[model samples]
Target: MTATPPLSAQVAVVTGAARGVGAALARNLARRGAKVALVGLEPEELKAVAAQCGPDATAWEADVTDVEALTGLAERIKAHYGRIDTVVANAGIALGGPLLDSDHRAFSRVIEVNLLGSVATARAFLPALAESRGYLLQIASLAALTPAPLMSAYCASKSGVEAFAHAIRAEVAHQGVKVGVGYLSWTDTDMVRGADEDAVLKQMRSRLPWPANKTYPLEPAVDRLAAGIARRSAHVYAQAWLRGMQPVRWVLPSLIAAVGSRDVARLAPRLAATAASRLRPVGAGGAADTAARSDRSDRD
Candidate 1:
């Protein structure tokens, strides 16, 4: 295996680059002098982020949930850049509903974008990463580490992302391609804003104590991501507490189960009352996307 290279002369491709943490990460990498490929569902937004990244950036919009779109993206990048040094699967959607009444389309969109999209990004770019001895960053959420009531869909999707990254990392350890999984805490992103505020999350907001004495901005996580790419870290947690939380799975599993049992009993009525879809799709005719995409995911 070879050492990870410096940002200069390196081309970093990031999904969900149009806004939020994805855009922030792109700006940080570009400032460090890395060439960047900004891929997202929104091109105009991507263009804005690209401009901020300077002349070394390119923006392309493609729904990551579409497998064909990703394949085309891979071909385009391989043709233009010849090699992509680092790839960050940063795109994800937020969805919340009771496990019973989850919208079929909305639910699938979350899983497709959060889980399948990450895997597709890796499959599409792994060759270049291995050849360049670069890095792959999979952005998982704090939800992946712990589940909350009314967030069964979001939790399941991100949990899959976290696990997939780990499995891939193990498979490719000797290929000179480093993979890192990022576990982040509650971010003030659009996803969070879009989710239905069920009683559990609301209670957490109002009552559930934050173990960390501080709540930091997304900028630090962006810096940590850049550093993770440079260092080829196996795992990166935005907040420090995640390091302790992962291993505590043994202890936490039981503790969280106990807490969840209490919360679920109290929150069940609110969860049951959420009969119809709580989401309003932000774009197009608003027909449907995630949950409507698949029935199996809808049930999840």
Candidate 2:
């Protein structure tokens, strides 16, 4: 690792920075004096965020699923900025449904972007991060901690992210590179907005507090993400109450087997009716889901 500095003019790279919490985090980091790289799939979207972040920000449009594309983006950022002090692997997608009827392509996409994409971002930036004794934040979810029924692919992707972050942290800790994992509850982001319209999901979001709401907006998570980058933390739970689930996550396996059996029996009809008529991902990413609900057969 390179010599550590007390944090000024540091370069921070944020994946998925084009929108939602990722975009918010990029703005927050820029405010805190870090030169930021805004990475996303859409240049126009990235430009919107970059415009707000001011001159210290650069935009990189690359699909996280494409290794060569993300690698090239990382190289370009490194070449321009000379170092990457913080890398936030924040790009993600939610693919949820019963494993039996889930869209296979969507499941694959989620794994590629969330699980593989997080790893690729870290791999591409690790050299510079190690050079700066920097930090890497893998933005995971509570799904990683506790797999809710009907979210098999999304759950698997995030669970993979958590384990990946933990192992990478262990590998790089001695070298002064700090790795972190972020767990957030359903925010008012596109992903959750998409999920919220569902009756079961609506019920789930209605169950959170401490932040006092399941949908606590993106600001708190964005603020904490910047703080974690500055302090070089190992993990940041956006909804602090997520910690309480740790004890239960251990029991999650048997709990699901026992509870899922009963809950699905009750939840099935509600999940089906709402999911059939109105289940759709919302916001800027709505293009993909516009025709997605027409037929499950069409997605495959």
Candidate 3:
């Protein structure tokens, strides 16, 4: 492992810093004495987080899906902070429902924000990160490694981000810009609560295999994320068990499929009647069919 430089002297950028994991991460970095640029879509909420982060942190409202806006935001942060030492592409959204009952657009929007947004974040910040030989961390999820019934879009997006992060790591390592991917299980975040609001979804999750059904506290995960940034780790797992799943991931999908097959068969009849539209994630956008979905409860 490379020795960490003084965080007090580094400037870090965290996307989706309005709430949940992103907000927590921004605060954690600030507590460690790093200057933070809080990036996200919620202005008032972002400002509130920035306040908690102190004078060294500032919030900018920019959607991660817009490349130009993100690029401009990066330049502005660079101009203000003088240099960038870390970039956490932590913005993501989620949609919940059986794919058969899900609106095609809701699923597409999740991919746009979670996967493509991470890609945009990486591209926008790469120039500054490369200049400083800094670290780029992508906030993926356990969804990336494990598949679940009501999270097809979410799983796909996270899985894409994981693969993209690895590919980017290889492309940029020579430039001294380290890339890291963070994997988290179900944490105490608004997204999980939003999904749980649907009784069917909640019950479905409860039936998952041991450890997989566990919901961890958020702060510990944030602490691990902060440490990962400091260490410039290749991969970050918020919970210990998450690390073990990495190696057995190949077997996991099959195991989960075997267990869920019965549930799927049982739920198939009820899924069509589950009012999936009402089950849309809290604070999601779009028309009745497709609104901006916030699976993570944080905007990017």
Q: Best TM-score goes to which candidate?
A: 3
Worst 10 residues of 3 by lDDT: 284-293
Q: 1 in model 3: Cα distance from truth in Å?
A: 11
Residue range 1-300, candidate 1, lDDT tens digits: 355578887999988787777888899999998999998766687899899999879997777767777878877987888888888888766555566566676667677777897888888888777788778988887777776556677788888988899888878878877788887776544444333134444464444446521334778767877887777688887767778887665665567678767776786676666545555222111223433221111110
Model 2 C-alpha lDDT versus the unseen true structure: 0.70
Q: Candidate 3: global Cα-lDDT?
A: 0.81
Q: Which prediction has the highest lDDT against the true structure?
A: 3
> TM-score for each prediction?
0.86, 0.86, 0.93
Model 1 misplaced stretches (Cα beyond 4 Å): 194-200, 212-215, 272-300
lDDT of each: 0.70, 0.70, 0.81
* Model 2 backbone overlap count: 1
lDDT-best of 2 and 3? 3
Candidate 1: worst-modelled 10 consecutive residues by lDDT? 291-300
**Regions of model 2 farther than 4 Å from truth:** 1-7, 204-213, 270-300
Writing each residue's lDDT as its tens digit, candidate 2 over 1-300 gives 455454467888887776678788888888888888988776788888888987978988776667777677778898898888888888776655566555566567667767887788877888788777888888887778876766677788889989999999989988788888888876666556655545675664454333434466678867876777777777787777877887778887676667666667766777676554433322224334432121001000
